[model samples]
Target: MATTEGDQKLDKSTPEGAWKKLLSAQEYHILREKGTEPAGSGQYNKFYEQGTYVCAGCGTPLYESETKFNSGCGWPAYYDNLPGAVERHEDRAYGMIRTEITCANCGGHLGHVFKGEGFPTPTNERHCVNSVSVKFKPKE
Candidate 1:
């Protein structure tokens, strides 16, 4: 962490307060407060570069680029997540029930999962995620 503001440094090795120190206000809001970014406003919404999408709060690999698809639903849409990388919970906010996905290792909010969408993907699921909650690491 930088003593001077705006000079952010991520100390990813530590799990305690590391995310709070590293994530920006907007990132923290979505990842910690479970806030959602405006539709079609996320950076990863249309991105198709080969990489892995990891939890921005904890650096844990969450989704693979191969699983990504253009669902035209605004936010980044994936057919599946990396096995065991995410945990699902029943989200009952806004009077509707939805499955919320979070980073398994850090408990940071990723987004919601919608199944039975009838997409051509192997898994008929769409993991709607906020770009601020995740970061992309290009394949090596």
Candidate 2:
């Protein structure tokens, strides 16, 4: 799939043209513009099966099932990311202090990371991810 950062203008010819045809304006907005869906409404929040989560926008493998944990934060949470799979940036958007996480391969927004979660995992980090940003692939 053709991936681009920020808002992707529909050219009305390529396969993305079909995607533009299929997805709603909001889906296009969040997937392409790195917009966040409302916290409690994400589909991945309750995904509990054993699987791998990949970037919805680019199909990049992001997090493994073993790393996922219940953070009770109303979103899919992970203790760590796949090595070199995601990139971080300083985000000052919406007048808040936070770091933005994006897929290293496609620059699609994944979520944010924060410290001091105190999870038993080696990394005491919490990767609070958006459900819309990922697709779950069940294990064999």
Candidate 3:
């Protein structure tokens, strides 16, 4: 992968450049380039907090703190998303098939969704999100 000077380190020197400076290459790839960070490796899997999770790319509101749940899948799981805030696509990457979710506004890759979540919620959907793709703002 070609690394731009911007890609070497997150340009966190300014609030506007924080995302670029704080995130790693893989994080930049998955979050900004719409690539997938390998599952079972995201930090949000073990995150238990009360906060709103916003898109790391554009700061768009995506999931509420209340919607988060543990799927035991080593990834951050949510039963729902903020209405009309995301777009889905059929991802055929790496010879495997999965549904890809992206931020509706900036088109930054969030993660994939899977069915059969076994949750009692109406959606029964599991939105497996990447931690690098999101930033949690805890409720006060």
Task: Name the top TM-score candidate.
Answer: 1
lDDT of 2 by residue, 25-82 (tens): 6665675677888877988887788989987766678999889988888888898888
Which stretches in model 3 have alpha-carbon errors above 4 Å? 1-24
* Whole-model lDDT values for every prediction: 0.86, 0.77, 0.77
TM-score of each candidate? Answer: 0.87, 0.80, 0.77
Superposed Cα RMSD, model 3: 6.6
Per-residue lDDT of candidate 3, residues 40-124 (tens digit): 7877778888888887766678999788888887789898899987789999988999999988766778999998857876689
Report the C-alpha lDDT of model 1 over 1-140, residue by residue, as the tens digit.
22224444333234436566667989878987899999999999999999999988767789999999999999999999999999999999999999999888777888999999899999999999999989999999
Judged by whole-model lDDT over C-alpha atoms, candidate 3 comes out at 0.77
In order of lDDT, best first, we have 1, 3, 2
Candidate 2 deviant stretches above 4 angstroms: 1-24
RMSD of each: 4.5, 5.2, 6.6
Top model number, lDDT: 1
- The per-residue C-alpha lDDT of model 1 at residue 101 equals 94
